[model samples]
Structures are given as structure tokens and as C-alpha cells.
Target: MTTLSSATPRVSPWVLSAFWFGTAFHWLLLLLILMPHDVVRFVGEGQKGTYLGVLTAVGAVMALVLPPLIGARSDRSGRRLPYIRLGVGVNLVGLAVMALAASALAGMGGFWVYVLGFLLVQFGNNYATAPYSALIPQLVPPEQRGRYSGVMGLLQAVGQLLGAVTAFAVGLLKLPVLVSFALIALVLLVPALITLRGVREEGGAAVQAPRGPTLTWRQLFAYQPFLWVFVTRVLFALGQYSVQPFLQYYNADVLKQRDATTSTSIMLLCIIVGSIVSALIGGRISDRVGRKPVIYVAGTAMALAALLLLVAPSYPVALALAVFFGLGFGAFTSVDWALGSDAMPSASSYARDMGIWHVAFVAPQLSSAPQGALLDWGNAQGGNLGYTLVFGIAALFFLLGVILVRNVPEMVGRRPLTQPDGNL
Candidate 1:
């Protein structure tokens, strides 16, 4: 098996191409079934918020454990490509299973099957995610991490475009429940294959798995930056994502929009377009100036945009807010992954470290469930305050991120920090 040593120092064209192809489907996987009413109806009579929260939470919790283990094994085994291949293959199967499961038990409220498929998707996604992610530090030059992250941000925005198209087709089919999930899963395969081919992992033929820490409190608390990042990540993400679960609901009830999907779709599409623009601009900005400024600007913008939705009337105006938020988010998103790469206290343990970062990402799904429940609680109280309350909370989370990120200065621009002390 081959590991980090095998890849060329300069960014491989094939590797960059792989990133462009591989990551496009991830956003859709998260955003596709986010509608409040739809999710609630599918789960159970009294279990919408809890169901949605658990679904989101499970992904995070899995990330917490799986990625680090996979990363450690990959890093030590000196083979990344095979795991990447394996992970992609698993992801494809999981998506197919999810679609099939959802279709089979649609009317019967076969929630377990759906949940089962979702868990499979989570497993497969990180199987690839932890290993493929470790490659960032290996392939991308330290100073250029931000630009690469921007490139990723560009691809993420593009994914939203793909999702809009995906949703449109589903709307036309008048399909049974959300069975179109299968079609979406099928679409994911193309990119996975291309990426698997395009980005060759460092090791493909050697075999020697590195032993990792067993489950224990000590093992969990071993890393410093990872610990700090995870602490901030769960709190911040829960707050930021608190609003997304309710967007469709907000449009229907609070905004009085007739077609919730159409209205939100436009806003989401605008976010996609605006994000693309910001990623390009942000790439240059991070390259010329630094990542901290970009992150600060983006985080601040998110707060303002979320706050705007609180008072905005009409879909067009709301989309206008999306444009602003998208720009901010684009800047942040483009470099967010790269920032994680920069904060590594030890590159030898890159995968393990990144797994912690992944935990920061996935764990929040659970914390944010309460935010959704809060909405359900409000709605039961004879008001449409759920969405508004969530968005306000999300704004606060964004602001907090802005504050926390400043302490971790930018390492992806200007000059590479030579001392290894994290002082850029």
C-alpha cells in the first residue's frame, strides 16, 4: 500500500481534478431532505424534531470515531488509494440502499429502513472522507491551502446547482414520497469513479495497519488543537445549522410563500451562484492577503444575512439576503477545510487529527436537534416562531465563529510558518 510518500510534492493535476469531481455530491447529501414538514411526516406522529436531530447527530457521532481510526490506519499503513476506493464503493452502495429502503417502506412509514440506509451512507462517506481528506496536507502546499479550500468551496456551490436540478426533476415526477433519493445516489457514482481514478492515494500496494488508541477518555483528550476545534465546532455548527431545518417551514408559514421549495430553491440557487463568485474572489484574497481576514469577513456576513431573514418579506427579498449570506459563506466555506488542515499540531498523525475535525463537523447534528424541537415547541404554542428563533440562534453561532477563529491565525497565505510553533 502507498501512503503520503508516494504522491508528488507539487499538486497533481489528477489529484486536483479528483477533488473537483469527488466533493460535489456531499452538500446535496446533507441538504436534500431538510424540509421540516416533510421530515416530520415521514418519521412518526410525534417525532419530527427528535428524528431530524438524531439523523443529523448520528452522522456527527460517527465522524467522531470512524475518521480518526481510519485516518490512523491509513497514515500508518502507508496506503490511502485502496481505502479511498473502498470508501467510494461503500458510499455508492449505501446511497442505493437508502433509496431502495425509502421506496420499499414509503407508505408503511418504514422509518427504520430509511434510518438504516442513512447510517450506511454515513459510514461509507467517512470511510472515504477520512482517508481522502488526509491527502490535503500531503498534496497542497501549506501556503496554498486556502486557495485549494476555495476551489473546494467553488465545487460545493456547484453541488447546490446540481441539487436544484435534481430537485426540479423530482418535482416533475410526482414520485412516491422522496424515492428520488435513489436517482440522486446514482448521480453520485459518476463523480466517485472519476475521483477514485483521478486522485491516486499515496500507497496502493503495501500493507501494515497502524494500531490506534482504544476507546477511552484519555484517547479522546490526547490532541490539543483538535480538542479546541471540536469544542468550538459543535457549538458553532449547532447554532449556525439551527436555522436550516426550518427554512421550508418558514417560507410556508411565516413568509406566507405559496411554493416553499420554489422560493427557497431560488434563494439556495442564489447562494450557489454567489458562493461560486466569492470562492474565486476569496481564493485570490487569501492568497494575496490572508485567510483570517477572509474568515472574519465571511463569518460577519453570515450573521447579518441570517438576521435579515428575520425581518424580510417576500421571496425575492429573502433571496437577496441569500446572495449576501452566500458570499459570506462562500468565503468561509472555501477556506474552512483548509483552515482545519493548517491547525494540525502534527502532520504525521494528519488523519487522526482531521478525524477530530470531522467530529467537530458531524457531532453538531445532535446538538442542533434541540433547535428544531424548539421550533416544534413554538408552533405547538400557536405561533410561527420556530424558524425565526432558529435563524437568530444561527446568526449568533456565526458571530462566535468569527471571534474564535481570530485566535488561530492564518497559515495558508503570506508566508508559511517555518518554526512549527503556529506563529505565522
Candidate 2:
């Protein structure tokens, strides 16, 4: 048994495997069971963008409010497995609901049924997410967190990539839409049950550390590093989504790809494959060399690559640029997650603090949500303006990211576990 505190011990391989299983299940469901495909069929043609935005905005809102509260509750309860168990159950059922709604597409279903199902999937995702993520800091010490976070990142990219393929397969199968949800549910349950088996909680209620600062985030964030890093992440999320949500549209409308679906399938596969390699390699490298140096390189590389995509005349060149961007994006993303883990002043409320950190990812939706408006604004100005302008905007964020990464203080160096906050 591996122990973090004097109270109880946590071990690996089992816990980590469990994490991967749940990760695969979650993304698989999103692409195949819940997202895209059928829900939009119900939206009147003209209002599809508005409806999708509403869907995204709703999830963003939940992302902002719920995760921190759930984290705090887990801290208060001094338990992680119970939360994980409950989360897995809800996630399975939510996928089941979404499958039902998807199969009903073009059938006698009403709009409300689709809306209800999407909401179920999204809301349940939040419920499961908040607690599950909170468990990471509790389990892994900082030295190993880079490798661990990288592995999780790899799982995420692969899971989502496969999920999209699977969803497309379902599209081919002409299977009842509900079967898609059943697939998601099965994937979610299998690993979740395996996860439950080996996940014994660490730490004793009797030996809790002297509680760290109870200061509200407003007060705590007065420290510059937190504010600065958070801002950088926000910018990255804004720029990232600005390009991503519309990539299919951009390919179809702008690139004039003869087969948009085939092209997108190829592009996503390449990007995800690159992301997996980058995460695995970058995490280990940063741990050895330090985090900031990698961030600087990633930011610059991605900035340049984004511009290359904007100007590429042919699909092959554009895809090449995407692979370039993926390398930089993956490096930064792997290290960035590790960096977030290192920056925490308190691991006692690991989820709460991590939630605050991740708000950088989620809150940017408010600004980036108007990607359509930004694209429209660019189109009015003409001459490949939207992609050009958006890529430039994303590049600027990467540039700012370089500046923000300069002096990140860490709780531990990447090679050894150290608790600067004295929680252990």
C-alpha cells in the first residue's frame, strides 16, 4: 500500500486503470450517444446554431457553479469513492436517456424529449465530473502527477476519437438510436465497477491537517500567479473553441471538400494521435526539464502553425498544419494540467481548488461563445477573413500564454513528491 498521510494508504495501477475506463466510457457516450447526430434533427433548420449554443452555454453554466461545490462537499465528507460510485450510476442512466432520445429521431418524438435528454446528459456529466476529478490530487502526489495527468490526457484524446468513429458506425448501422445509449452505458459501468473494487479512501478523519486558508477565491486570487495563469487558460479556451466547433463547417463550406465527413474523420484521427504522443512525451520531458520552458515552445509553435492552416490552399497542407498545431497544443495541455496540480496551495480541498483552476477552461465560453458572431464579423470583411482572424486571435492567446508561464511556483519539483502546503 502507498500512503500520502499518516492515516490511510492509496495504491496505483488499479486506481489509474479505473480512471482510464471511466474516461473512455464518458467520451464514447458523448460522441455516439448524446452529442451531435440526432438532437439537431429536431431543431428547425434555421435555429440549429442557436440551439447548440444554448446547449453549450447550459453546460458552461453548470461547469462554473457545480464542480466547486461538489469538491467542497467531498472535502467535508472526507470521502472520494462514495462520490465516484454515485457519479458512475448517474452517468450510466443519463447515457441511457440520451440513447432513447437519439433513436426516436424522425419518429413520433417531440422537441421536448430531445431537450430533456440532452439536459440529462449534460447535467449528469457535471455531477459525475466534479467529484471524479477531485479525486486526482487526493490520490497522486505532485512528482508523478505529470505522467499521470498525461496518461489521462492520452485516454481523453483516444476515447473521444474512437467515440466519434463509433458514432459514425452507428450512423451506418441504422440501429435504433437507443442502442447508442446502451453502448455508452455498458462502457461506463464496466470500468466503474472495476474502479469501485480497488479504490479505498486514504486519510483518517481523526488526523486531518491544520486546515489551510479558508479565504474565498476572490481574496485568494489576489495573488498574481493564480490570476495570471487563469487568464492565460481562458484565452486558450476561447481561441481553441473558436476554431474547433466550426471545423466541420469550415471544411465543408470553405475548403469545399468533396467529402466533408471523410475529411473530418481523417483530420480528427491525426490530431488525436498526435495529442496522445505529445501528452506522453511532453509530460515526462517537462518533469525532467521543468514546465515553463515547454510551455514557451508549445505556445510559439502552435501560434505559427495556426497561421499556416489559415493560408494553406489545399486539404493536405491544411491537415499538415493541424498536425503541427496538435503537437504544440498537446505539449502545452499535458504540462499545463501538471502545472495546475503543482500550483495548489491546499490539496485538502483539491477539487475546489482544481475547479477554480479549470474555470479558466470553462469560463472562457462566455467570450468564445460568440464564435459565430466573430466568424460573421469576419465574413462581412471578406477574403478568408474568419479563419484568418480567428487563427490570429488564437495565436495572440498563445503569445500571452508564453508570458504568463514565466514564473510558476510549484508545490513539488517534477521528480519527487513534496507537499509545500504541509497537508500530508
- Candidate number with greatest TM-score: 1
CA lDDT for candidate 1: 0.65
lDDT tens digits by residue: candidate 1, 86-202: 776777676666666555657435666666666777787788777777667666656767667777778767776777655655555666544556555555666666666655443
**How accurate locally, in lDDT, is each candidate?**
0.65, 0.62
Question: Which sections of candidate 2 miss by over 4 Å?
Answer: 1-9, 17-21, 24-34, 37-40, 44-47, 106-112, 171-176, 202-211, 376-384, 414-424
lDDT of each residue in 7-111, candidate 2, tens digit only:
222545345545555565565446323453343476643444345445556657866776677767766766666766776666666666656666666542555
After best superposition, candidate 1 residue 176: deviation in angstroms?
A: 6.0
Each prediction's number of clashing residue pairs: 11, 1
Q: lDDT of model 2 at residue 176? A: 68
